[model samples]
Target: MALWGGLGQAATVAQLVGADVGGLISNIIQAAATARQNKKECEQLARRVLMIADLLPHLQDPEVMRRPEVRRPLTGIDDTLREAHELVTSCQGKSAAYQFVMAGRLADRFRDVQSRIDSYLLVFPFISHIDITRRLDRIYNILLSNDTAGPSSSAGSQLDVLVSQEVLVHRHGVGKFTLKELVVATNNFAQEIGRGSFGRVHKGVLPDGREVAVKSLGKASSQHGWQGLLRELDVVSCLRHKHIVHLVGCCVVRQKKSLLSFWRKNVEKQEELLLVYEYMKNGSLHDHLHGPSSSSSPSPVMASWKMRIEILLGVSRAIEYLHDYAGVIHRDIKLSNILVDSSWVPRLTDFGVVVNWDEA
Candidate 1:
């Protein structure tokens, strides 16, 4: 049983909800505080972890954990904890300057966790949620005080604004298709292939009989997902890398037809957004490395260090392209975001939450 008063629902694992946030905190505390930057970043990450810790116990209720809606946010939290654990541990015994460099990466990870927690706030008790926007404001002020950049172009201030912040999406780069086309391709949304936090994906065959994966955004997150789709289209449409998911087309179905009353109208609520991509026969690296989704046995090919290193290198190149050439930040980079094909080659997907360096 969980501590404090008995919970009505079976407790969802605290480790699952809170993940390694606490562990990261303790690890940082034990490490030698060599540089001002290292210590500052450590404190900031601890704060983020503490915010997550506050919500952990409350989310243990079976009612909350059992909800399908909670799965996505929960997975994101788990991924963050995993990344933090790796990062903090890797910094051990490094020089003060090296740790300082790692601090920069930690900031990126903190913002990624910030974006992940937004979805979690929707489904459960995030009643004490911290205001991330205010956190960004603090960074902005700090930059101004330090004279890092002029008011017009504050680099620290830009990074302070979370990737979840709204932006004007553009459409000059990608193909726009209608709902009819999507329906025809998916055979009326047949073949339930997989699912993610935003929506479900269906396997489809194109007019040329080429295989594809169609992702449909969920209703509750329709607006959020649309913004992401716009961002994804803008990013992926311009990039051509072997390790990047190809953006075949997209669908946005909006209806203006109203019932008798405005209050009863299903306007934006009824809209649908879908994105099409080339199908990956092997699904995701998460499935292979950890184990098959439906089974306990790990994929032998992926379990090898040699294969894993190659997979890691391919993903690194793709990310380098996004950062160095495309000039965008992939706020969400987790195992599930990396897909693999029949040859077990890794490819990056889901660019909706990526922020341009300028936009930060």
Candidate 2:
């Protein structure tokens, strides 16, 4: 059997190796075909370049091609092309093999350098310090074809690995978490600390030992199968702010058992539809402002009128940051989701219900 044939079914293998090889293979093949096509294009370009060199004198006025400065550079290029043409033409037997080998190496090096230049120009005529590395990937085939002369599956595979490496690094920096890491962190969604109309919340700790509150979602009352959860997750994960609750990460995988695991409760398996967060110790403002005093405390640290006013201002500032600065609207702004820290710092929580004005 193939090493990965039934591997997708095994949770361990699926988590470690990922279940995207078929997709990656398809992408690699597509890129290779593109590179092959590009090589043909570059071959055509080579012909054109030769033609342009030959016709330079006739195409341009004598004055343009003859001026000492302008003529010198054209003459230089003409001489270089002449040398290349002679080297290519003079190949007899073994010398021809050597010339072809040298040409391939030179072309490969030129193509690599050309690929870097094209990468810079991707989002360019725009900025010098800017990088649109992913766009460069779209023309991988063309660049490879120009450089390599012909396509090889091995070369495609190599390029696939290279691109994957770069994208993976970028993803890590962008704060992507794998499925297993989320699963173990949330105690398999066992501990339900909070609940609401949209979902149940659970407490978890990250690998770094940071405590986090995870909101495990349920199917929307109107929609089936957690479709709305996904949209919310995507939006929240992209949003970054100091005042708003930081969305650490989320999980979205589709496998028969794994999908079933989320709704089911077996000790051995758990499904994941939870958003990780930085846990707040001092509960919500509703709790502090209204809930009964805790038994452990000698007496609740009741907020004076001044403290109360300060707390209200803190909440207002959080909303202002989201609405005016971040261009987001807290559609469900209320006292319950406004959490307080040990330092009495108020944090805007519960982004699940927030409305993105930009999206609207």
Candidate 3:
């Protein structure tokens, strides 16, 4: 009855909440300088950015992550950061004067977001103004790099875009999986082994010949799942033990339809959500307990009393580790959630409804 398990069913995106504040600031500063229009305004925007830049280290501080208070403000700032990045991106190919206008508008946004975060900082009193000032100074040095006014007047070109893409990769811990790669690994999702409220689960074989289970969340399920995705990802990423299921990675592709573009690229877009996990060789304990088997008779591999007690002990230990060591609660424990390996060792799985023990 010994089972090994990890407790994540469908993680929402919140677990991926960390933003490279330094990178975002760099992008905005670089873009603004290239679009040189109002030198005074550009400097003003740079100063304003000092506020958000100062908060970067604190936002990324391990202690800050431990506090739920930071999550809301951080999320708010994450939006502003993304908006600033996109605003700078959209300014590309625009006139210098237009870029200046966009930069001013974005600076105002940075100020507003910073104001909101300042209030959140009250909870983390140890994060001193001096700490922020030092980070801001570092940002100032970076912003004043000689790329001002940009080169060849095409400052908003592919080179800048490539730099931004590079920063994007550093933030995603599990590494982004391409839709094409996933297509090949899942054999076009050809092998369907189970279905659930969230979506279908397909047993897949990676390019490296490793077995995996890919769970695809339907649009409706994703809409609901987004509420808890980040927390799940955060919890599962930290959990490492012999009895827990391992999360290899995940895929979250989004698409939207558009009319014919200037280059006439395809307008069709879609949103696909997928979670990848290590394949459990022996399926779930529920299957062996009360589920169907190959021979339609009471199999000799019956749940002996000794094996049953061992299974209970294994599950208890898994729960104990999650609760005491990980500060996580296995919220949806059941027979089906306990999976098994080739050795009849039970592992825990499916953490769709987990909660931080402290919060609980």
Q: Which candidate number maximizes TM-score?
A: 3
Pairs that collide, model 2: 35-141, 39-145, 261-271, 262-271
Backbone-clash count (model 1): 0
- TM-score list, all predictions: 0.46, 0.46, 0.48
Off by over 4 Å in 1: 1-173, 254-271, 293-300
All candidates in order of TM-score, best leading:
3, 2, 1
**What tens-digit string does per-residue lDDT give for candidate 2 at 1-360?**
232332233332112223232232223223333342234434433343333323222212332323344323223332333333332223323344564667676466445534432342232122211122333344354434633474355654454445433332333223556668777988786777776446777888888998888776664433332534544554555556555677766544322222222122231222346566778877777877677867676223263666677777877887777777667776777777887666667777765555678676
Q: What lDDT is obtained when candidate 1 is compared to the true structure?
A: 0.60
TM-score of 2: 0.46
User: Candidate 2: misplaced stretches above 4 Å?
Assistant: 1-174, 219-227, 255-272, 294-301, 358-360
lDDT score for residue 282 of model 1: 86
- Lowest summed-lDDT stretch of 10 residues in model 3? 1-10
Clashes of each: 0, 4, 23
Q: Considering lDDT, where higher is better, how would the candidates rank from best to worst? A: 1, 3, 2
RMSD of 1: 22.2
Instruction: Report the C-alpha displacement of residue 168, candidate 2, in angstroms.
Output: 11
The model with the greatest lDDT is 1
